[model samples]
Target: MFAEFRKFVMRGNVLDLAVAVIIGAAFATITKSLTDDVIMPVVGWIFGGFDFSSYFIRLGPIPEGYTGSVNNYAALKEAGVPLLGYGAFVTTVINFLILAFIIFLIVRSVNRMLARFEHQKPEVPAAEPTDVVLLREIRDELRKRPAE
Candidate 1:
């Protein structure tokens, strides 16, 4: 059973999947950072400095013991406020779109490269079998002989 488990884990596809998962996690982090740190900031600037992350609707009254500003979404949520955090949801959606777009571009480029490689490959004709070649040679020799 141990050997079987090792065999399964050592398979090329399994290893490749593991590596892909690790790289995918790293890529997701990069996409998240790009969305949160760069694109969101630019979008906020374009929209007159309106931060999307702060856009939420308060569903319940703030806790009496909460000392954070009422306008602060994160602080209010942390203090057990029931709020509809649509801004955070939007940010997450944007992150997903960015990651998906990047993956699509990568897949498209790899497909194009594969297509080019296939097009450039030289197609060699298959060689005839030894019996077929010998038969042809015999027919040629017979044709070359004088009529008897």
Candidate 2:
């Protein structure tokens, strides 16, 4: 049972999955940074500096007429506020779009490269004109020579 478990753990698919998970985590970080740091900022600038990161709604009773900017999401929750956190969602959506676009470009390029590679595979050489007929002709000539 231990050997079987070890074999299963060392299987090709398991290793492939582990590698994929690690790569996916790294890629997620890159996409998150790209969205939050570069792409979202440009998009926000285009939309009159409208920051989606700060767009949240506080749904609770105002505590003793206290008015202060909520810094973190934890603070809002700590203040007993029911919140609508759409900014993070918007950032996630943007990240997804960028990741999808990059993947599409990669797949498209790979397909084009594969098509060119297949086209260069030398055309199967057209079946080589069948040597059976020539063999039969030689056999008939030898038979006639024996008779002569």
Candidate 3:
């Protein structure tokens, strides 16, 4: 059983999947930082410095004895306030779009590279079928014999 498990784990596809998952996770972190720190800030600056993540609709009353500001979404949520955080949803959508576009570009470039390699490959002629070879051999043998 242990050997079977090891064999399963050692398969090329399994190892490739594991590596892809790790790299994908790291790429997601970088994408998130790009969305949150760089792109969103520039977008906010263009739109009069309004933060998208702070836009929310309060669905319920704020908890009593809450010292945090009412306009702050994170603080209000921490104080058990029921709120619809649409701004955060928008930010998440943007992040997903960016990540998807980047992945698409990478796949497209890789496909183009693969196409170039395919075109560069030297073409080898296919071998004749067994029946065709045998027929040719019989024809040659008959041609060598005396006319009958």
Instruction: Estimate the TM-score of every prediction.
Output: 0.91, 0.71, 0.83
Worst 10 residues of 3 by lDDT: 44-53
lDDT of 3 by residue, 57-92 (tens): 999997778888999999998889999998789889
Query: What is the C-alpha lDDT profile of model 1 across 51-121, one tens digit per residue?
Result: 87677899999988788899999899899999998888988999999999999999999999999999999
* TM-score, model 3 to reference: 0.83
Order of candidate numbers by TM-score, starting with the best: 1, 3, 2
lDDT of each: 0.92, 0.79, 0.92
For model 3, name the residue pairs that clash. none
Native-vs-model 3 lDDT?
0.92
Between candidates 1 and 2, name the one with more favorable lDDT.
1
2 or 3, which is superior by lDDT?
3
How many Å off is the CA of 14 in candidate 3?
1.6
Q: Give the TM-score of candidate 2.
A: 0.71
For residues 1-148, write the lDDT of model 2, one tens digit per residue.
9999999999999999999899988988998898989888877777675566656677765456445556555566666678877776787888999888987998999999999999998876565445976888889889888553
lDDT of 1 at 28: 100
